[model samples]
Target chain A: MMRGLAVASTLIVVLIALALFMRSKPILALKPLTTLLFSTAWHPSRGEFGFLAFIAGTLWVTLVASFIAIPVCILASIYLSEYADKRLREWIGPFIDILAGIPSVVYGMWGVLVIVPLVKNIIAPLFGGYSAGYSVLAGGLVLAVMISPVIIHISVEVLRTVPSDLKQASLALGATKWETIKFVVMKRAMPGMIAASVLGLSRAFGETIAVMMVVGNVARIPRTVFDPAYPLPALIANNYGEMLSIPLYDSGLLFAALLLLLVVIYFNVVSKMILSGSKWSLYYNG
Target chain B: MDKKNNIHVRRLEENIFKSLMVFSTGAIVLALALILWTVIRKGLPHLSLGMLTQAPKSGYYLGKDGGILNAILGSLYLTGGAALLAILVSLPVVLYLNVYLKKGSPLAYIARFSFDILWGIPSIVYGAFGFTIMLLFGVKSSLLGGMIAVTFLIFPIMSRSMDEVVRMVPGELMDASYALGATKLETAFKVVVRQALPGISTAVLISFGRGIGDAASLIFTAGFTDSLPTSLLAPAATLPLAIFFQFGTPMPEVQGRAYASALTLTLIILVISVAARLLTRKFTKHVV
Candidate 1:
């Protein structure tokens, strides 16, 4: 039974690879694969299948989201691990977990009802841009909210590992609590914190439905955050339903899935190595 | 020479930073409250008993739905089937990792690493993978396909969580079992499983919550249907998709139903999370 379960668990990976290989057989030509990666125009109807635009859009949104999420996560981690009393910590901890539990689709719904309008009616007009509301900025903001909990949870764990004695040593030298955190805790937890952020980045990279509902799924390279854009996951999702309509269309979408899987694998492996190097295990060390 | 002044400045900075940290922590709570409030406020008015009991009407997307009975039943069926499949597969793998393989074995290490990596793969990717497999098998979207996709999505999570639990079973207990002439298999199934039941159930509940709330993964594999699913091969409706479809429609009544659906989904998740907590507490009392 045990071996059978192990085989079953591993089978999923094998099946995914096999499925991708089978699906891409029709468009295995080198010419199309290169065009699929490098072409700028994404009009599948005219047989134009460049993916650079979506790649750019995905990167841009992820970068913007990281900028927004990292600071809040670090601050919240420091507050939770170092400053909050036991009572306060107990109250706050569950909310953070609950934040993580909220479904992505609900986040998208919130984005549709809240964030998008805030971007459209408030933020956009201030920047002299039209508030179509479903722009890259709107998507990035939603992604930021979605990923902050992940970053906070990991970062809190990393911060908690900083030996309490170190803080006392600083305090014993007449340093204030914040001074100890700033000079001692942050420096010691830096690597693990960086790993936490990377994990969050990888998560944002693959998030689909929430980003889709807000990102204004135009298959063009966005010149500004206010402009509409498309990410790779959204592309696969929006087009998958219609993929069978055109020649090589199904294969094209499958290739995108393959690319996503490969990229995510690379990111996760790198993250694991980084965390291990920092002596941080995702599970409890005991 | 200005050492006294430097100390004073540092103290002031510390005070400012502490306040900032408090504010940021407060924001997390505020955010959660805001999300729940918005969902309830917008979703409450359209939430009716009929909405829960009936299927969507012909013009349901136009805000004239029967209740979301089809989606509710479909989600239940999909989550139930998928959760059952994942537990059966994961329980053995977890036991083997802890009992069959020696600690620090490279094979066990690699298996753990693989599941960790699998845990990070996104739902959309799973959907795409499922769609590809379905195409290869000449199968149409159906309840079975949706369960298969969700099974893949939750398998890694369930295994990893259970692995953590089983790993926590004290080594002394297993040794005592061996001393009593119990075989490794017997000790594993009889001893470790009883000890790890609470954690295992918690893992299953968490996965069920995940499977039920997911929309992207099931969208490709479970084609939507207005009628309730009667067989494994039948296409199914799910609350997440129903909410998505309803909210996207260009009608006020339909959009209102979207919130009601969102509320329903939230309430279900809330109940599951609470139940998981209660089960963990109850089972921990039994852990000897």
Candidate 2:
């Protein structure tokens, strides 16, 4: 009973802290929160909060990042989980495991020393100077690669768990191997696939360090993939350590975090419900 | 004979696709290998004990060795202590959550909502929150503050993984243990825990690697320190933070060392993850 009390109290401390920190009155008193986040200027040192340029830039980069990631990862997961031979699967699984473990710092270092120069020197002229050094294209492209392993892992797990009896029954009814996989396995795994994709989306939504190093941190919406922009996490990372005040301090920083927290929680709940709610029907359908 | 002919064609088609699959898989392997090679190329040639034993040294080409030794010790002290603390707290809460909370309860749903939200809040948010708490307590850049940030970052993972390993302990086993006159605690500690130990261990290892590899979260909460971590109450340097610091600075040697340090960190994470997966394989085999 004492142990239970202890656990409950601890949880209450953390949750209540979050609420108190994000209370409505406290939030509104800080800055014109919307104007800060949505403004076109972001010259904090000069007292301009035009973040519209950065806000748009961040979303564009993330969208393109996820766009590049989702398709390749979906294909890779399908191939690895469904089509690869036993020996190949054995090898492929561990390879991806290590890939997932590669730190973001390493990815950032590679982008800085190698990829930035390529964009600035070789790729820029091709894109009409839009591919200028350390652009969003470099950051988003690196992020696409960085997040692929996560997508593959989740999708492959969902695929691997598709009930074998479904495949057998489909095949038993004269369906081709491909047809069985396409109609039955894919159908059965659709919800889990959605869960996996949502998970991937969350990873993309808040990726920072590497994105910061390579994205150029310019406070403007990129006209093309080659232009640079700042993101919420990157913004915090780039300026948080140096920042020291109220109109541009912890509250503003926490507000961005609050935004990330709310969105992430929503998707997480959606995915959990999708998983648990559909598991029964998927079992029956399979 | 006709069956044999069909098998031959099928074999040929399978072989072609197999090659494609192998090539694709190889592509991923090649990417990781290239990253490691780049790190070593950029970092190893300049690596020395100076990078690990002294303060954040800069201007290596000018014979200056900005040492990261303090950061190395600091990262270890902070991440290690925090991991131990998180495990102690989260393991039981997770087990209790699994054993008693009764899935789908409003309380359970709320608990889960918070856990998932914790995962989604980026590392920077954690840093910001930790910074607030620190300012509230008047303890900035201390290892304790870093631990606070890390505990939040890792708690959700530990609990979620625990919930998974526990729930996967086939309900039939629990029923049998109860039928044999075992209490809930007895059944949990003996039968369910033993059965799922492998999975739980893997989960712990995964979180351990995550805690160690994190740089952004710890940076603000625990600013860089120049001396050996004599106490958990002092600021310190971690490998990830050192890499971030070096990346922006103008020292070829420091830059190289940053790569090397990042390489080391990645290697550590990879090893833990591999071990976790291998351990998980045993439990899954049992699970199936």
Candidate 3:
């Protein structure tokens, strides 16, 4: 019974992939896949169907989010695994869980209510000489908050898998805790930490509602952090309801989903490779 | 004396670095508290019994008259159905990974890899996929379509978490069960299932919370209706969508209702997370 179910699970994934490919096949023939990938003019009503703007938007938001999440997450994981006592660890675990469990829509609401105003009133004006707030910066900040918990959780696990004796040996030799962590533990855990960041990037790229609510959803390539941009997932979520009203619009959105799928698959495959190559199956042993 | 000076400098740097990390961890706690505080401060006053039990009437978006009962019930129905489907599909696949196949088999590897990909694929893409399937089947955005999309959304999370739990079960215990002349299927169902029941339950509720709170995945597939759905074929309104719609409206009263709906959704998720944590702790005492 279990074997049959396992095969069925594999089959289900293939079926979804095939269905997505077939749905996007129509647009595939009209334009070269490369053109679809590089063009940014997404005016479905005018039959202009470039997705470059969304791609750029996703990259900008995700990169900014990574900039904020990666360093903070790595430092926190090191502290949680190496420096913190049992009490601090206990206090932080549930907070991480609560952060992870909060819904994206709620985050979107928070973005709309809080982050956008902060950016509009303070950061954008202070940094960019203006205040639209609903720009890539706000979206990136919200995404940073959303994906940090994920990166921290997985990274802490990866760091914990390093043998305790390695650390103890370094300490016994009079090496400081920071030196042991920097020279030994961090080196051993580098691959897993990279995997954690990759996972967080994949998530930030695919986040829809929160990014959508703050990203301003304009189909233009952003020239500054204060400029509005349209990420691919946001494009699909915002236009999907009205897609049938225009010619080839549904197909365009379907192709966008297909594109997002490919990118996400690539990231996940990379992260999985790192996890497996790290030779520490403590987390992925499942 | 120079060595002592170097030691002092490094110690100072270490202390500074440690404080930075502590601040970052504290920031996460602060962020959660701030989110809850904002939602509750704005939402608590508008939360009423009618919001839970009555359907929205005409001019509801204008804050004229009505409640979010349709959305509340619809969310429950959709999540309940999706959770059931996720369990049925996830249990056997997870069992196959741990029980039927040995570690590092190609088929098992593919199953795990594919689920990881699916797990990372955003909920909005699942909405598109569901919309495509609905088009092919000639079905409108309805309860069934929403359930299908959400099942896909939560299936990987359910299976992967459960797989971890099952992996932690001692191999010797399973070997001992087989030594008793139990068939592989019997051993899996009788011994493995019982051993992982608490973890399995936690996975179920986690998936349930995920399905319940998701909005983008349901927007195009489930569609929306002001009235409660009477059948799987009918359109259904969910709490997240309700919040989305209300917030989009220009009226302050309705926007307040949006916050109330958000608080409702947050509280539900909090309950599930707390329950799952408690269940894991309580059941760990009995697990071998």
lDDT of 2 by residue, B43-69 (tens): 777677666556654444343656667
Candidate 2 lDDT: 0.71
Tell how far residue B22 is off in model 1, in angstroms: 2.0
Over B164-224, each residue of candidate 1 has an lDDT whose tens digit, in order, gives 7899899999999999999999999999999999988888988888888888898899989
* TM-score per candidate: 0.96, 0.85, 0.96
Chain A TM-scores for all candidates read 0.92, 0.84, 0.95
The models' CA-based lDDT, in order, is 0.84, 0.71, 0.86
* Model 2, span A1-286: residue lDDT tens: 5247335724743663475356323445745867776778656666555456756766777788788777667767778887778897888777776667666777888888777887888888875775657888888777877777777777787887788899999989866565576689889888888887777777777778888889888877778877787777787777766667644554555666666666666776687677774432111000
Candidate 2 at residue A204, lDDT? Answer: 71
Q: Write the per-residue lDDT of candidate 1 for residues A148-249, one digit (tens) a residue.
A: 888888888888888999999999998888888889999999878887888788889999988999999988889988988899998888876788998878
Which residue pairs clash in candidate 1? Answer: B51-B67, B54-B67, B57-B66, B63-B254
- After TM-score superposition, what is the CA distance of residue B231 in candidate 1 from its true location, in Å? 1.0
Steric collisions counted per model: 4, 12, 0
Best by lDDT: 3
Model 1 residue A258 lDDT?
80
